[model samples]
Target: MDGLNWNDVRDLARRVAQGEPLLLTAVTRSILLRVAPQVGIAPGNAERALQSGATAEELLQEVSRRISNGSRRLSRTLADVERCRVAGDIDGARQLLNDVLAVEVVPHYQDILRANLAALDDES
Candidate 1:
């Protein structure tokens, strides 16, 4: 992660989304390996996809779709957590986050969920 920047992968996604014919160069591959896990994609899966002769466009599109889906799920789950909190069901909110942590692959979202759980713990 030292030499990796999330923005590089994001820019690549943006470029690909805008129809840029970006090549799947070594640099691109490296960026994907680092950023994929943060977006809920296993680095190994991305590596396998890259090695499977898929075009850069296809891989990038898949990554973009996954990122979108992960974001949406996180939003919905957080909203549910909020609802539980508003209803004075702290245990339910904690359970919701724990359930997400059990399956969520995105590191950023995991951090958020963990932080929310910690906050709930503090309240108790």
Candidate 2:
């Protein structure tokens, strides 16, 4: 929650605006809880979205697409994080790679993610 970023809030707002059910992973949920007060959206709203059975993956994809298109590196980072590991844990060398992506712009981030994924494939 302490590390909650503005991108998370923007994504939550977009989901609310789209009438998309909130599919919050635990980390995402924590971010939302911290941001709810600032956005004027209640924590209950996110809970309700979860209760309504929204697919978090779908919502995350939507957010990623929007962010990617908008040239926001943070969105790309989130997507990379989501795809790179399950349940949000990017350990070992992957974690180091993600840290680099986290500060990049979208265009650069996309290239980096693609390269990283390819490297992973090469390893496999």
Question: How does each model score on lDDT?
Answer: 0.77, 0.53
lDDT of 1 by residue, 1-124 (tens): 4533456767888987687777778888877777667676676777777774355456677766666666788899999999999999999999999998898766777888899999999987
TM-score per candidate, chains pooled = 0.72, 0.28
Which digits, one per residue and each the tens of the lDDT, describe model 2 over residues 1-124? 2442558657665776688655556767666455443333345654554443354444344445544454555455556655756554445446746575565443444475668756655554
Task: Single out the weakest 10-residue window by summed lDDT for candidate 1.
Answer: 1-10
Tell me how far the alpha carbon of residue 28 in candidate 2 is from the true structure, in angstroms, after superposition: 1.5
Enumerate residue pairs that collide in model 1.
none
Candidate number of the best TM-score: 1
lDDT for 56 in candidate 2 is 40
